[model samples]
Target: MSPVRRRALVVTLPFALAWAVVLAVFTGLRDRLPDPLATHFGPGGEADGFTGPGAFLSVASAVLIGSGLLIALGVLRTRTALRAQRPVVAIGYGTAGLLGYAFASVLFANADAVRASRVSEPVWQLGVAFGVACATGALGWLIAGRDTAPEDDPEGSAAPARLPLADGEVATWTRTVGSPVLLFGGVVAVLVGAVLAAVGPGVQAWLIVIGLISAAPARCRVTVDRRGLTVAPWFAPWPRKRIPLARIERATSGAANALSLGGWGYRITGRGSALVFRSGDALFLRLATGREFAVTVDDAATAAALLNALIERERGTSEQRG
Candidate 1:
């Protein structure tokens, strides 16, 4: 194992120990907890749900253990597989810490409540908890730092050669892609609404909003013209992306994977952001700000080549003017 990986593991050790301590403390105090613990609290800081102490502890333990193991496994796998795993490991450890602290605080608070025979207001300061976790993770990542440079994608050279255009020529291309994310999100929202309805009627109003978002058309129109690249859903006018030619540093065509982009649908990955609809070749852009952006669409090779040509042409025009 590399020295960096060793450091990462060491940095995460304290958090794991913290989890263990919290679990042990809560278990020792289990006998002191009330018969039916106030498991859920409402907005007004009142008990809304009750569960046996055993069930609560069981669920908490399972979530904590499962999540911690998954994150640790992720760090190990990513460290072995990718050159840059600092961000991934850091975020994972930080999130684990955040969850551990949150659960521990909850358990302790409820125990106190049971002993005192009084309702427990939510004592966890979500902002502070999250902030501390994120800070710790960021620190670990900074300490671990970048281990190696990212390897070149073997298939990146497969992009089509830049198209040739005349000095005054203006080119345009158009393609449409289906966005299944809305459909999927819509289905999930409807299911959630059904579950919420069973719990209470107050959540019914949010169902309408979810329904509208889901029912919207799933087609996105992608256009590349003299005005640069424009991507917008066919059904919406205001929500669109217009990347001007000047801001684009480079364009390439490559296969996109949901796992790499962390589950797709306008995802923000460590490298940059992606607007992915399906897994296939996509037009990737390196912006002047050194950020990467991508959009998955059909015939990405042609788009990438044309985009390169256009960028060169724009720069050429400016050079001639000077």
Candidate 2:
């Protein structure tokens, strides 16, 4: 087997085994349990039958296990593609499974009675199964999704030569200017404050106004050019601070744990050393000066590959000259 296939099988095997075990236990329990609703409707309830908790658990386990396996298969098959695209596809499959269950429930099950009871036993069972499957699938994708080598440029152009920074050239990391989420939140807050101010005049109304002003978006930027690295906040009257690139020890991409990192406006994390633009991935720059800078950009892997290529070219040129 190819390395990719081997890796996929290894990761998926344990989960599959666990799922089967759980399914067997659930089935056994369902066959042995007595009907709970039997007392409610007397003898009629006995005739109506009872679906045990084990049945629900079995369904959930199946969904979770099945989804996980499918996600693993997807990763194994699409190992060379871009990282961001894989999750979307895997998640889509999980979502479809949930929708399928919902459709079945609506067509054949008593959805109104389920809702009236407020128990949602079936939905919960199916959701848990679906969620487990999706989570495992996502995990599989993350573990096996990386490409060992940089993808070739589609343009088929020769690689560019890297020019050394001539004494004063600098490298910096900075945040992107403007955040749509912060702006939207600020606008909403301001509108709410205005409404409160118009309704009544009091200390609380002024407090709302203050809160609105304080919540306004703040901008920060990092720039590196011929001069040096500079970091400055947007919409602020301040001088930019210069930082040298030689101080940069390493740069790596940040993983998005929550959708928050890649959703609605700018999100800064990793101790504020990284910034991700509206729905963009983060890049971390570890400087020799013991400071880190983070910037969010689109297609981080491609950028990283290009930067690595440039660095290799520069090193080669230096060696040839010496």
Candidate 3:
């Protein structure tokens, strides 16, 4: 294994082992806990539903342990040797860390409830769990580093040459792509919300929020201009991504299959990050830093051509400055 891969294994396995130990400890102490421990809380922090200690332990352990094991397997089975697979390893370890912290939060909350004989506010417990998980994830990122590489600019890197732009000249192209995945997600969320509404308003409210968020990426805009490339969802602009023309190394048009990219909607895969909407032509961007990004949108060929022209102009300007 490469040094990077070894480091990833080291960073990931500890969290898995730690969570395993925690599960064992919790199981040993289950007798002291209440029968049917309160697991879910309402909006006002009251207990919503209860599950037996055995059931809760089994379900939580299965999910957390299962995720950790799957990550380890993927890392071990990856075909590339020199390639670090840093994002995969980091995300895997980070998710395990989050699950570990969440499991601890549940344990502590239930421990307190068992002592008091009542379910108190789980909001604080879960909030703290989230904070800790983020910190743990950040630590994993630090260990793995940025995981970016420079693209090898072999011949035929750029899209077929377009009319070369004059120095300081500007051009732009814009298009919108609708996401079927987002639509499907919204539908599923709505259906789940309706089903959960039969239980209680508080539980259903969570699903409603999920549905709204799921619909946010229903349509996204792609803009390529002198400034750079921008990908922003129609529902919000603050979360947009901008790639300055200077950073882009190459541009090409090709198919954007979600299956190859490992699902869709703001995906991070073996290639890099992408705002994937559909399984069709996309403008593929290779940055100077070696990172890759793709935007699946209509009229990708024009976008790629215009982008390449701008990049060439930017390179000429930079060379003159040097």
RMSD of 1: 5.5
TM-score leaderboard ranking: 1, 3, 2
Candidate 2 structure quality by residue, lDDT tens digits, 127-238: 5667765765576456535634233221123232233444433333234455454555566667767765565434135555654543443344655442334556566635
Candidate 1 on 148-256: residue-level lDDT in tens?
5343351364654588888778789889988676576767677767776677534555875775565453578888887778888786765788899999887888776
Clashes of each: 0, 8, 2
Per-candidate TM equals 0.66, 0.33, 0.57
- TM-score, predicted candidate 1 vs. hidden true structure: 0.66
- Top of the candidates by TM-score: 1
Task: Report lDDT (CA) for all predictions.
Answer: 0.67, 0.44, 0.68
Query: Runs in model 3 with CA error above 4 Å?
Result: 2-15, 66-95, 111-117, 121-123, 146-160, 163-201, 204-207, 215-250, 253-274, 277-282, 285-293, 296-322
Reference-based TM-score, model 3: 0.57
What shift in Å separates residue 43 of candidate 2 from its native position after superposition? 62
